[model samples]
Target chain A: MLEAFVFATILFGFFGIILKKNLMMKIIAMDVMSTGVIAYYVLVASRGGFFTPIFSGETVAYADPVPQAVILTAIVIGFSIQALMLVGVMKLSRDNPTLETSEIEKNNTP
Target chain B: MNQITIVWIALPLFLGFSGYLLPKLDRYFVLGMALLSIAYGLQRYVAADTLTLELIDSFGVTLVVDSLSSLFILANAIVTAAVVIYSWQTGKSAFFYTQAIILHGSVNAAFICADFMSLYVALEVIGIAAFLLIAYPRSDRSIWVGLRYLFVSNTAMLFYLIGAVLVYQANHSFAYAGLSQAPMDAIVLIFLGLLTKSGVFVSGMWLPLTHSEAETPVSALLSGVVVKASIFPLARLALMTDDLGLILAVFSIGSAFLGVSYAIFETDSKRMLALSTISQIGFVLAVPAASGFYALTHGLAKAALFLIAGNLPSRNLRELRQTPIALPLWILLVLASLSVAGFPLLAGFGAKTLTLAGMAPWQEAVMNVATVGTAIVFAKFIFLPFSAQPEAKEGKKYTVGFWIAVLILVGGLVAANGIYMDAYTVDSLLKALIKIGIGWLIYFLIVQRFILKLPRGMEQFDQLIGVMSLMLVLLFGMMLT
Candidate 1:
């Protein structure tokens, strides 16, 4: 049930990307989508248990370290891509101050 | 010696990043690295055994250098070298060389990496570098194109990541060998992501726009080699399942017809070339066994053509017809264009034969029809007149890079196909001639009567996402049955 909800979150973000006319909203939606993916990985990692990955000298189930490690790398990559997109948005705004998709499209058409 | 596999990816990356410090010498450094990569790739191609390098054993991160990847490595190296050479006279900024060289390394890594995690990382690096390259001009339009490319590609990759994670959850391994045990849904999602990246069907609609809008050499790289990044892994996955292979085959045929139909009516010369890329890439996807050879042939030929397009005075076909081209450049254009149209004795002919050898009769027939369409599209180039202008001396420096690219293309054809003896038989020659003749006749007799435009707004940003989601649902439906 929780996994289904996570998928909904992803779908909601994706719809935002598809439906939003504002470029900034689309970027935010992209972030929302990626965050949802990251959340899904987190949920998967904690499926075993929520205990620390390090040894605690007790008999306890620890969360999967692999997904966490992988998601860390993913987070960094996602951050970088978002930064690049933001930079592009700023640059694009120079020509079309509104930053609306329709306006940008009109400007782009030769 | 297997450890040397890392060098193939790392050298360019190291040089590219460090290039910021020595902006003046960066181009030369990248050029030398590209040449070294080609030489090393040749050495690996000649050797018989597959080499595997284990980078992180616990994570299953390994680089596999096999016959299949060696061909891609060679193609990537050659195209990089050609792009670097072609950009010489254009005087691109240091950042351009940096991104180009980085893209080269990441592409090589994507081809050789074995596990999903490493592959994802490599692909992300490739995407970053490609985005920067596309936006290199800093113009508003180029930035918009780059952003759209990034958005679409990133969304597709997120799907891929989810699929990768699902596979891991099922099999407890992220390696390609572990994919056989993955669930159907995971495989479908993965295939969808890869197909998008490879510029197949609806998801690939961004290709023509992105490829046509970038700088000339960048356009050559994107069309010629960058799109092949996902195809290597996609082919590997298809090899594991018959259902997936059949699905891919259907899409490949569809992409071929769609691309050529677009190319047949496109008036912009560069845009036509971009559409033809989508068509030729379909041939690569159709026959996974021969994909490497087909990609190499198409990559070299397409790169040469784009380099030639850079030298042309105008992007419009009508304008091109009015302006005469230098004799030497015109010859090069004809040779490269003919090779892409699958003329006898060229690299594309041999690649096409290999691709068709394993296809069903109906698929083969459809592919042949697409071949005629391809010939018709390129016939526009063949009909162009040679230089009648006395002032051709003004831009002679530009032809230097064109000569270098065309020479490498011809050299690649000879080296790879070795005269293509089997493809040169009378029956095949006659078939090729007939196709070319019919294509030209159609161009001269029928196609000149109309000016057709692709329905507007299909390739826009929002529509792209909508189409992608529709494709995901469609793929799910197809896979379920």
Candidate 2:
């Protein structure tokens, strides 16, 4: 059930990216999609158990540490990419001001 | 001794970050790194031992240097050296050298890494470096192009990450050997992501625009080596599954035709070269055994052509006719163009022959047709008038970088004689001539007749995302059967 919901979040983000004409909206949609993927990784990590991965003399099950570690790196990468995209968007807005995909395309073509 | 492969990845990265502080010597730093990498690659190739270094034993992150990867490392080194030399005359910013050096390291890392997790990190590093390089011009237009490239590339990589997670869920390992236990859906997702990165078919539609818009040396790097980065992984995947290989064959052939058709109609010289890169890469992907060789030859020749294109007064095909090139540069252009067109005695012919050897009969026929199309596309450049123009003396001054790049390419062509000796057969030569003849005839007949235009909407960002999603669904459906 949780997997289905996570997938829905991903699909929703994709739809937003595909349907949104504004460049800023598209960037946001991309972020949402990345967040959904990260959530999916978290869910995967949780398959081992719900408890914290750090062992402290507890008998309860602990989540998989590998996926958590992997996703941590992925999260850093994702954040940096998002920052770069936003910076690009800020630069782009200076010239066209509207930041509409159509207007940018018009200016791009010869 | 086995751990030496790590230095290939480490040295450039160290230089890339540290070179920034020493801005005046950044170019020399990059040049030294490139030369050192080439020396290391040569030493490894001559030793001919497959070296592997385990980073974290449990995590399966390994660095490997085999014959195939060593060749790529060598190619990357040579191209990096040539690009650095070329950029010297262009007077590029210190930032460009930093990114180029970092890109060299990341590309080498991508080739050397042995598992999915490490490969992902390396690819992301490459993406970031390439993004910075593309946007180095700092124009409104380049920023937008770089942004689109990053967004689409990251989205595709996220899908790849999800696929890697799926593989881990099933197999409990990220190594290529563990792929045998991977689910079909996971493989399909990985395939789609790599397809987009390699600029194959619908998924890679961003390539032509992004490659053409960048500065000349950056375009050379993008088309020459960066685009081939994903193919290394895809080739590994294809080797593990016959189904994936079949799928690769289909998409590669499609990409070949699509790229050539676009190139045949393109008026912009750089855009035409960018499109031809898509097509030539198709040849590389078509045959796994020949991929390394084909990629090396194409990388050298294409980088030379792009460096030469940098010297042109106008990029438009019609405008180029009014200006005649100098004799020496004209010869260099002819050699590079013919080599790319797979002329006998040049490097591309041997690579093309090897690629053709692995294809089924029908696919071979299609490849031959695409070969002719490639000829037609380059014929536009080959037949340019070489007569002296009044402004040619002042308008065109060949720089030191230009000569250096051409020399590297020429030397590469000369060295390729050993590899292509077996491909020199009467029947193969005859077939190559016939293809070129047909292509030349077609070019002459339709020189001014056809004006083809692909849909503008297809290249738009939203449409690209839509196309990628649709391809995912389609590939998943195919995998079910």
Q: Which residue ranges in model 1 land beyond 4 Å of their true spot?
A: B388-399, B419-421
Model 2 residue runs over 4 Å out of place are B388-390, B393-395
- lDDT per residue for candidate 2 within B238-320, as digits (tens), equals 77566677778888898999899888998889989999988888888897767888888898888888888877777998788
Q: Predicted candidate 2: interface RMSD? A: 0.9
Q: Candidate 1 residues B107-217, lDDT tens each?
A: 988888888998899888889999999999888889999998998889989888898888888876788877778887788778778888888976778898999888888
Q: How does model 1 score by TM-score?
A: 0.97
Clashes within 3 Å, all models in order: 0, 0
The first chain of model 1 has a TM-score of 0.94
TM-score of chain A of each: 0.94, 0.95
Q: How many angstroms is residue A58 displaced in model 1 relative to the true structure, after the best TM-score fit?
A: 2.0
Please give the CA lDDT of all the candidate structures.
0.85, 0.84
- Candidate 2, residues A1-110, lDDT tens digits: the string is 99998988888888888888899998889888888899998999899799987778868888888888998999999999989888888888889888899899789755
The best candidate by lDDT is 1
Per-model fnat list: 0.67, 0.74
